[model samples]
Target: MKLDKELVRDVLLAVEAHDEPDRWLAIKIPGKSDIEVSYHIMLLAEAGMLKADDVGSHDGFEWVPTRLTYKGHEFLETVRDPEIWRRTKEGAEKAGIAGLGMLVELGKAYGKQLLKERLGIDLP
Candidate 1:
């Protein structure tokens, strides 16, 4: 399954919305199959963004994301705002920046620029 950054961001947002850590949450994005969602969840877990447990057989397993890590929260904060996410993705694509970490860094930079512009506060 191909990884979709938008879907991954949406999944993180969904997970963040729910505060319960012990409960199992099912991510249901329209037009996305269970396997695809599970694959993204696995990727997020591998990236250390979330904690997930694999359940079921090796051939057909389900990924149950338990909770978001501190890194996940930071990443989400970078991309949570719609304008920041759009600008960050566009800038990253233009600069050929790959990898989630790099994108998040770019987003943080853009966020700082936006803050500086809005509040006239110098951010280093």
Candidate 2:
């Protein structure tokens, strides 16, 4: 399965939105298949974005998301802004940069731009 940026964002948001810190989250996105969501959840855990438990069974793979790691929070913060996320995706597509590393870099660049424009706090 291809990397779905939108789904990645949604999963991150869902993890972040879970209010109960101590309980495991059941992240279900409407219209998204269980496997697809499950795959991305695994990817996030592998990428150090989320702290989760790998509960792979005979049926298939699954995870119980606990919370976001520091890296996860950093990336989420960068892409949480709609405009920044939009610009990051657009720029990535235009430049043919599909890797998550590039996406995060692009997002950070746009996030810095947003801070400069909105709060006049320039970042080097």
Candidate 3:
């Protein structure tokens, strides 16, 4: 299965929204399959954005994402705004950008651009 950016955002949002830090990130998005959610959580784990434990066998996935990392919070902050997310996606699509790495970078760039526009400050 291919990576879904929207689902990725949703997963991160859900994980961040969890109030109890002691509890694991348990996501259950309606209209999404369990395996799909598992897959996204697993991907987040692999991406070094989340601290998770893989407890599944070789057959399927069963992850327990504990919390987000510093990088995860940074990325989430960049793409958290709906307008920024839409522009980021639009810019990336126009540039034929793919992969999580590039996508995140584009989002960051868009976020910086927004800051520059709003505050006349540029981030290095």
User: What are the per-residue Cα lDDT tens digits for candidate 2 across 1-84?
Assistant: 978888889999999998886778888998888778888888888888988887879977788788888998999999989999
Candidate closer to the true structure by TM-score (higher is better), 1 or 3: 1
Weakest 10 consecutive residues of candidate 1 by summed lDDT:
95-104
**Model 1 C-alpha lDDT versus the unseen true structure:** 0.84
Q: State how far residue 105 of model 3 sits from its true place (Å).
A: 0.7
Collision count for each candidate, in order: 0, 0, 0
- Candidate 1, 34-87: lDDT as tens digits: 888888888899999988888748689689888899989999998888888998
Candidate with best lDDT: 2
- Extract clashing residue pairs from model 1: none
Q: Which regions in candidate 3 have their CA more than 4 angstroms from the true location?
A: none
Q: How far out, in Å, is residue 79 in model 1?
A: 1.4
Kindly report the root-mean-square deviation of model 1 from the true structure over all alpha carbons: 1.6
TM-score of each candidate structure, all chains considered together: 0.89, 0.90, 0.88
Candidate 1 Cα outliers beyond 4 Å, as residue runs: none
